[model samples]
Target chain A: MAAPVRNHVWVGTETGILKGINLVKKQAANYTDVSSVTRDQEVNAMCWGDPQESEILMGCKDGTVKVYSAEKSKFTEFHDCRGGEGVFRGLGVVDNAIITCVESGLLKVWQEGASDSLELQVGAGVQKMRHCDAHRQKVGTGGKENDLKIWDLQKPEEPIFRAKNLRNDWLDLRVPVWIRDLDFIPDSDKIVTCTSYHQIRVYDPSSPQRRPVLEAMYGEDPLTALSITPDGRSVVVGNSHGNIAVIDLRKGSVLCTLKGCAGSPRSIQCHKSMPLVASCGLDRFLRVHHLNDKELLHKVYLKSRLNSLLLTSRDKWEEEERVAPVDQDVKDEEDEVWDGMETVEEKTATKRQAVTREPDADGVVKVPSSKKQKKKKKVA
Target chain B: MPHIIYSAWGSTCPAARPPGSVNNSCKYSDAPAEGHGAPGPSLEQDVLLPPTFSVSEIKNKQRHHYMFLKLKQDRRREKLALKKKRKKERVALGDKAPPKPVPKTIENQREHDETTETDEFAPYFNKQTTPKILITTSDRPRGRTVKFTEQLSSIIPNSQVYYRRGLALKKIIPQCIARDFTDLIVLNEDRKVPNGLILSHLPDGPTAHFKMSNVRLRKEMKRKGKDPTEHQPEVILNNFTTRLGHSIGRMFASLVPHEPQFTGRQVATFHNQWDYIFFRFHRYLFKSEKRVGIQELGPRFTLKLRSLQKGTFDSKYGEYEWVHKRHEMDTSRRKFHL
Candidate 1:
């Protein structure tokens, strides 16, 4: 007998259970549970990975990020962003941290499981971060300030590198122009960030002072989401008007627009395994498309906007949301792995502002701020 | 306690790190508002907000139901429309002007045999003296293994006496390949075999071997048997010419009975159960290609015996049945609903 093809289609809907579709035989007779996500909470984003790892993760409208072990039909309560599962519209898996693009204008990250003894490694509140320009070796943090600060674990508080905002080269910093979506070119050192007012700027982070390599006009609407082929040849953008356009990066031209797709697409992901693309829209439609052939694979109707999705596969990554305060009382133990790690240096340095108060009865540390305040008052 | 947790991820690369967290420095933690207490006031303030928006939710529910109903209706309409279109195409095929409706040729339509109108079997000669002989092909023509032909022929001698009902392609293609094949071998004879069901498998070869095994509801016709009037089996085999170009699955051969006593039911049952073993052909059409065929009933054969095994499930058993197996033969076109 010939070998049967190994492929299955997993779909998430707003109501009922998730469905598994077998395309080879044109069969639509299988169903899985997304309710393990949240009872009546609209599934916002879904990412597929290995099935055995039960690594399928779903973000629901209830403000909860639920990581499900679909193989064993189990789920771990990952995080609650808003309240239940807040209005999550964007989801991306970069490097095991799940990157969520929410309506809060704040980017949040999550990881797999509980850390060793609840020693706080990192906190949330991820800001303007992009892996742009000649590919990102490190993450860039953007604030209301005029400079783009790039951070490395070796030095956490201060940026290892910074870029001045040419548009606002003044004494004071300007509020950022609301960056909406970013796409990293596969196997290259380039990233594209689509901002409000229909502007997609291609930047090479390695060259901080330079202008964008290629700037494309997206017309007059804000993009809700974007995706890039792993080869970095084509870019697909989904806009707020429920419009989806595929752009050939090499030619920098719009290849084509999908029709009969009615809704404002909030987020979209291009599947690497096949010529398929998935997008979520305000029309409550999660449409899977065949990118190369421009055929609609399937449209899963949801009750709310789809934010992110990961397909099925093997070892899974879950966003580590919360950890207890690190026990500062532990005696210096050489075997403690965190003592030798780079993040330890970075995390402690970021917490240095409070280090000024925590001396632990050792004169080795001194807080100078209180003395400075006393001298200023005496002068006044 | 020594902990050995087997962590698995849904990725092809088992050892690779998770996506999105390049630095793996995801800070920020949110835990359930630890009971009410805070700035002296607890974090449970969100609980005081109206539990879910009833009005907005009601409106959304109505809209969702509307769309669901609409989609269901659209699917139903699509299926009905496709079925109707297919039915129309099949029906149109039978009405096309057929080539040389043998019974309605200009000459045959003009000629009149008033004297033969008395007996249904009376036409050319006296039926009383000539005991009608039925011809049955021995399931082999040419190119067949001699042993096969002999084994089959030995089972019923006088092989040429049986009526055959198939076309030979390899021998007939050179004479007619471009012409639209329309002529069929029809025996308008009052043979000992019932006229209601005339079956044959002519021009036999090993490759042309087919087994007729199923039973069907056979229609029977009658004629006045007492008349000693002029009547005989009209031999339709004129020059024994093949009209079609080539055969893919349906071969060109004739089938009949060795003896003349075969009834209408027997002939129809054999015709219904007929099977020609061959390889199945798979065809696909390009989007840009123009198709000339309007309606088609293509039956492909298969030599892969494994394909003949029973399906993963049996409908009657209502569950998995792994033991009993069956061959996947053609002719079961309607056995499983599309």
Candidate 2:
């Protein structure tokens, strides 16, 4: 009965600490330590690796990264990614490897279970460098340098399968570029790659040169976050604005636009079996949304803004609950205690500050926040 | 709506490694480790569209939290009511409390003086060799298969399989020994049975999994006061497996221990990218002290197996990658590490 539960959302914050939102009881728990701390700079980008223990690996702003253990009620720093300059804003997780977007337009891949004794090994950057979505053979992710490059652990420098074609599209003829936010469709042969200026092009992994089986242009808005459904039927993209847009993958059209998020959603993630969509942004709210119904599932706002999110399943949470003091929800009841006071005014004012930094940069119109921020409102 | 929130406070399912179990990747994992030598470097970037992320891909996860919240509230409310009742009794009786609700009330309501419902002389005798015990035992599956037939055929002493069928009353065992068996199921369903075998109609995969060896079903005569074969369905017994450890359930009956398990053909069709799992299990005996484990069968052992044609039940079929998905009762037990 020691398995990890899918009950809470893990949050990577600016302070290099791992924060969590218990979906069950609605509470905020923090894991903070700096022994093998990844980054000391403002935690820029983060993506939670699959739950190894109670910890999730995170890429940071300081050209560094690290693994933070959520198992420790107190944050226990696990690893310090010393491999390369940390991720600028993007992170891709496969099995134990953390593929992050480094500043040099290069991808840094790191493995979990690495004996992170030193900070070098902890947030050790780019152990095996490779391309994203090489595993997802469906969609094409344009190429690097003049051709698509995939690094195989088989041969770290070279790709298992590189460019299937050597043709240029309209944009390539205009301005050549590198790929960002690349993902493969689950159980399919589709691959998705997002680039600067909100341009997302898809290619069949089997045939890289063929026209994208699906393509969507987000105009000038850069895709802030990207995630695929477990079934790979849909996709969600978040931008500078506090909005998340859902799109149908098969048809490649906008399904719905949700505007309730209070801050710029940095990263959005969906857990395996449990229906949970986690998003974190400058707003400091770790919000969990139900994917099936597109409803707010849970929110745990912390003192610092959230940059990345991860989670284990329900059963793992149950094990921790026994060791916990009380129900996490009971803690949420504190919301009522501060009603009708100066604290409320100060909170609203802080949100106003957050709103300035988070405007709708993507094509999605920001949804009204009056009712959308309910889960987050009760928290902070 | 009944919502179950995965509580941060709840416990995980009982887990065990079954000796050499490999922690499987999520079913939907792209780089499925299904016995892949190891993950290849994914840094090869051929630009394409990443799958679109949608809100529906993550909706209604609130049930997990609510489940935990409601459970705790229920427990808290119950505790308060118990305290209130104790206080009320203490105040009224001056420290001497009355007994609580009647114990085993269901037992008192179970008696019936009805006479034996059916006659033994009828073709479908309704009374047993002993007095009508009304014992409750679990039912064997109505779906019979080749494995069941083979097992049943073997369970019976081959020489004495049809003592009653041949009308040899002298060989009848007079006693109905209940100790050797955990449950006795007698199914008389309208199944597409073979010419003479009762288990002939069952699905091959599971019937083999059920360990029906040394079992037999035959038509017998009603003694002067015994023989309870009836035409009606009744649950004579129940012995549902309990969770002792992780996967204890599947070691005996679980064919998909952690397999999105690909048949070699499926693997080849998917170019071995579909992932593969070799199905294997250890058989079980009711009283065996050592639990049947999966490790001995071989963990992560890939059988370059191919897929069988659809709906083809060649009982002695060999298309499956692994035949050892099942174990026989006579399998020699060996020592292994957990």
Clash count (model 1, backbone only): 99
* lDDT score for candidate 2 against the true structure: 0.40
In terms of docking quality, model 1 is: incorrect
Candidate fnat values, all: 0.00, 0.00
The 0-to-1 C-alpha lDDT of every candidate, in the order given, reads 0.39, 0.40
Model 2 lDDT per residue over A188-258, tens place: 65666554446555656467455456767653444656777655787777754355777778777877765
lDDT of 1 by residue, B1-338 (tens): 00101011111122232334332122110111222234454445545322322122334676546544644665587678778987777677766734433555685567544223221122212332222222333223332222222322322222323324454433332222233221112222122221111122221211211222111111111221121111111111212221111121122212222233322111111111112223111122244567532111112112111111011111221111011113322335533200
Q: Model 1 fnat?
A: 0.00
Residue B15 of model 1: what lDDT?
A: 25
Q: List ranges where model 2 is wrong by over 4 Å.
A: A1-7, A33-39, A44-53, A72-80, A83-101, A105-149, A161-178, A208-211, A313-380, B1-338
Q: Model 2 reaches what TM-score against the true structure?
A: 0.37
Chain B TM (all candidates): 0.16, 0.16
Cα misplacement distance, residue B100 of candidate 1 (Å): 94
